[model samples]
Target: MARYWDDHTVYSQPSAEELRRKAKESASTAKKKGKNYSPIMPKSRRGEICTSWWGQAWCRNLESYADYSSRLDRGKGYVRSGTVIDLQIHDGKVLAKVQGRRRSPYNVEIRIGRLSEENCQKIIDKCSTRIESLEKLVSGEFPEELKEVFTSEGGLFPTVREISFGCSCPDWALMCKHVAAVMYGIGVRFDENPFYFFSLRGIDVDRFIGVALENRVEKMLQNAECKSDRIIDEDISSLFGVI
Candidate 1:
C-alpha cells in the first residue's frame, strides 16, 4: 500500500535524487557573472559599433569592415541603421529608449508593468535564439525545408539595422530616427501580444519560461549547499579555537 497519494503536482515533480544530480551538473557549468556573452547590438553606419579599441581599429580598416559586415549580415537579426539605446528593468517597470529621425530625432520610450523576470528572459532568449538558429540553418551543411525564411536577403536583421527612416540627416551615423521606429514597432507587437517574438519563431513562450524557472530553482539549490558548507566550516573553526 502507498503511504501517500501522488497527485499530478507531486508526481510530476522531479525525484529528490534527480534534483540533486541536476544541481550538481548545473553548478559545475554555471555561467560566471561577468562573462561576456556578445549580445548583439546594432552596428553604426560608419561601422563603428565595436566595444573595444581593437574592434574600432578593425572597423576603420576597409577590408576588415567589409568582411565583418558580410558575416554579420549573413547572421540572423543583424540590424544596421538604428542602435539600442538602453534596456532597463526596475520595480515592476520596464523602460527602453530607441532613436528615430535625423531632423526631429524621434525617440520612443516604453513603460510596462507586471513584467516578470521569467517573461523578460524568455523574450530575450527566444528572440535571439530563433534568429540565430535560422541563420545557422541557412549556413549549415544540412538541407532545410524553410530555406526561404532564413535567406540572407529580406531578413529582419538588415531591415531593422540598415533601412533609412524619416531622418534625412545625410550624416552616416546610425541616429535616433531608425532606432525609434524599430522600438515603436516592436513595442506595439509586444503590447498587442506579449509573446509576439515566440509566435514569430513558432514557440510557446509560457512553456519556455517554465523550463527557465526550473533551471533557476536548480541553481538556487546549489547555492544553498555552498552556503551550508561555509557555515559548517566556520562552526568547526570556532570549536577548535575554544579547545
Candidate 2:
C-alpha cells in the first residue's frame, strides 16, 4: 500500500514518493481496464507546465485568481506525475478521468459557458482584420493585438462565474485535487489542438475566417474597378509572393 496525497485513511502526510507511486499504480490499473488516456506530459526543460502561446495563457488564467491559485499548485504536480488519465474536449465541456488511490479512476467534468454575443462578435471583428488566416491562428502565431481580444473582460476565456466543475473523488473540497488535475489537463490539451479552445467556449471559429474572406472579397472588388476582372499573375505574385 502506498501513501497518497490527501488520503484521510492514512495519517502520514503525502510526499513526492506518494505521487510517483500513485502515478505508477494508476497507469497500470487504467491500462488493464483498457481505458484510453490523454495524459499531460512532464514540464518542458524550462519547467513550464505548458509551452505554447495558447497553453501558457490557459495556465496563467488558472493561476491569476486567488481562489484557484493554491488548489492548482497540487494539480500541477498531479499532471506532472501523469495521474490524469484521459481528457476530452467537447462543446462547452471538458471531461477527464484522474486515477488516485482507489481501484477506479475518478471522473471529472468541467463545463465552460459560451462566450457572450458581444464578446464573440468582438473576437470575430478584431480577429478578422488582424489574423490573416485560420492557419496562423491555429498555429499559435498571431498578432499581439489578438491577445487583448482574447483575454479581455468577457473575452474568449471563461470567467470564474462562467465555469462549473465536478469530480467523483471522495475529497470534500469544492475543487478536489483530482478535479484540479483535469482542469490543468485542459491546458495541456490546448497544445495538441488550439481549435479546442474555441470549441470549449462554444464559439464558431469559421466566423473568424469568414470575416477575413469577406474582407478579401471586398478588397478585390475595390481593386477590380482599377484593374482587371480576373486576378492577374502580378496580383498573385504580390498577394502570395509566388510568380
Candidate 3:
C-alpha cells in the first residue's frame, strides 16, 4: 500500500533554501519557454504577506475552518518564497499556478459559491444604511462595522462548506501546500485590490454601489414628497380656519 502524505514526519520537510532554489529553477525554465509568470513576494518587515484589513480578513476567514488551518503555515512559506507564479480571480473562482519541488508547476482552482440575490440585497440594504461604511469600502478601508457585515453568517465571505478546491498535485491531503499557497496569494492580492474580493464572489462592486446610491436617492425623494404634502395640508387647514 502507498504511504499516506500525513505519514511523513515534519522532519522530512524540505528546507526553505531548497524550496526557493526549486522555485527559481522552475521560473527560469518557464521563462525560457516564453511563458508569463508573476510571483508573490512578502513585503512586510516580518515577512507578513497580508497587511491590510481586507487581506487579513480573507486569511483569517480561511484559517477559521479546521480543514484548512493545518496546512496554512506551509502555504505561507510557499507564498513568501515566491512559489505562486500566477493567480487570477473571476466569476466566483480563483485559479493559480504554484511551483513546488517538482519541475512542473501545480495548477490550483478554488470555487466560492455566489451569494443568493436575497442575501446580497440584505447586505446592500445594511450597508446603504451607513454611508460611512460605503465610503470606507471605496477608500480601501474596512471599518469594524463593515467587517461585521462580511463576517456575518451567509454574508460576503463564503463558509467552508460553500468552498470547493482542487490542486493538480500528488498530495492526498484535502488542503495541499500548493492550494494553501494560492489561497494566501489571493489574500496578498486583496491587499492591492480590495474589490477583487467581491469580484471573486461574483459581485460587481460598481453596479452594487450604483444600486445602493439609487436606493438612497429614491428614499430622499419620498421623504421630501411626504414633507411637501404635509406642508400643503397645514396651509389648506389654516386658510379654511380648521386650525
Q: Could you give candidate 1's per-residue lDDT for residues 20-76 as a string of tens digits? A: 344333333333543221112433333344433323322233122342343333111
What ranges in model 1 sit over 4 Å off? 1-186, 227-243
Off by over 4 Å in 3: 1-12, 45-48, 136-144, 226-243
Q: Which one wins by lDDT: 1 or 3?
A: 3
Each prediction's number of clashing residue pairs: 12, 0, 0
Report the CA-based lDDT of candidate 2 relative to the real structure: 0.74
Candidate 3 all-Cα RMSD: 5.2
- Over the stretch 172-219, how does candidate 2's per-residue lDDT look in tens digits? 777878888887788888877777888898977676567655765676
lDDT of 3 at 9: 42
Q: What TM-score, computed on C-alpha atoms, does each candidate reach?
A: 0.23, 0.76, 0.82
Candidate 1 lDDT (Cα, 0 to 1):
0.34
**Winner of 1 and 3 under TM-score:** 3
Q: Which has the higher TM-score value, candidate number 2 or candidate number 3?
A: 3
lDDT (C-alpha) at residue 52 in model 2: 75
Query: Which 10-residue window of candidate 1 scores lowest in summed lDDT?
Result: 74-83
Name the better of 1 and 2 by lDDT.
2
Model 3, residue 167: distance off in Å is 0.9
Which candidate achieves the best TM-score against the true structure? 3
